[model samples]
Target: MSSSNARTQERELTFEEVDAQIQNADLSEFENQDDANAQSLDLAAQLKKVCSVYKVVKPILSLVGNAPFLPSSWKSAVKTFNSVMSTICV
Candidate 1:
């Protein structure tokens, strides 16, 4: 066999080894996504508190909603913002 073929076989993994590597990668990806989701929820909670304290909904919406070609989701987000702002301050 040629030296290149010998090197290729040496670098190749068995089916089980490749499967294990793929599983590890998938678990790692899931863990990273979970971390990102937790961070997003935490940030949203923090922003909600800040908005409640400062009554920032109108200003926030004005800044973001005025952009051209806003999505339908943004319109729903605006409604949510309005609802959030409507809560009676303690």
Candidate 2:
């Protein structure tokens, strides 16, 4: 055989070797996707818990903000809370 042909043959993988490599890559992709899904679920659960607390606290803040001998800074803090709740709940 020519030198170039011998080199090419040496570099070529067998079909079974190529298939095994592909299968390994697919398995790794599945593992990565599982990790991604678990992280997504974790974030969703945390948000749900936070929003639950937001439901209880928002109206109390509103009531306190409206009818209190508080300073302007307290009102501003309530506005900040409202803005944050709007961002998160939507």
Candidate 3:
């Protein structure tokens, strides 16, 4: 094999070994209930922000009655925004 090809293979093997070590490590040794609770609280705060936005926008959308296209667009926009927020919360 060429030197570049050999180097690439060596790097791949090294990465695989590191990944295996990480996967096999006893993660529970580093786990902490307090840390988990703090993360949960942070996520709750983000969810509250999304809920507030939904409440504020829904009333505006309701006022735009009889405008089928506009309402459909607003619905789609809200769905997309909520999906993005949910992904970040996770």
Best by lDDT: 2
Compute the lDDT of residue 23 as modeled in candidate 1. 53
Tell me the spans in candidate 2 whose CA falls farther than 4 Å from its real position. Answer: 1-41
Q: lDDT of all predictions, in order shown?
A: 0.50, 0.58, 0.49
Candidate 3 has an lDDT of 0.49
Per-residue CA lDDT of model 1 for 3-87, tens digit only, reads 9645633553345544554454423322334546656667667565555443422334534544458887886787566556655
Candidate 3 C-alpha lDDT tens digits along 1-90: 468645743432343544554565554523454756546667667476545444333333323422456667776776566556545533
Off by over 4 Å in 1: 1-53
For model 2, residues 1-90, the per-residue Cα lDDT tens digits are: 469645633554444544554454423323334656657667778587566556445545555555458888998888688778857865
Clash pairs, candidate 3, are none
TM-score of 2: 0.48
Maximum-TM-score candidate: 2
Q: By the TM-score metric, which is better: model 1 or model 3?
A: 1
lDDT of 1 at 72: 72
Pairs that collide, model 1 = none
- Of the candidates numbered 1 and 2, which has the greater TM-score value? 2
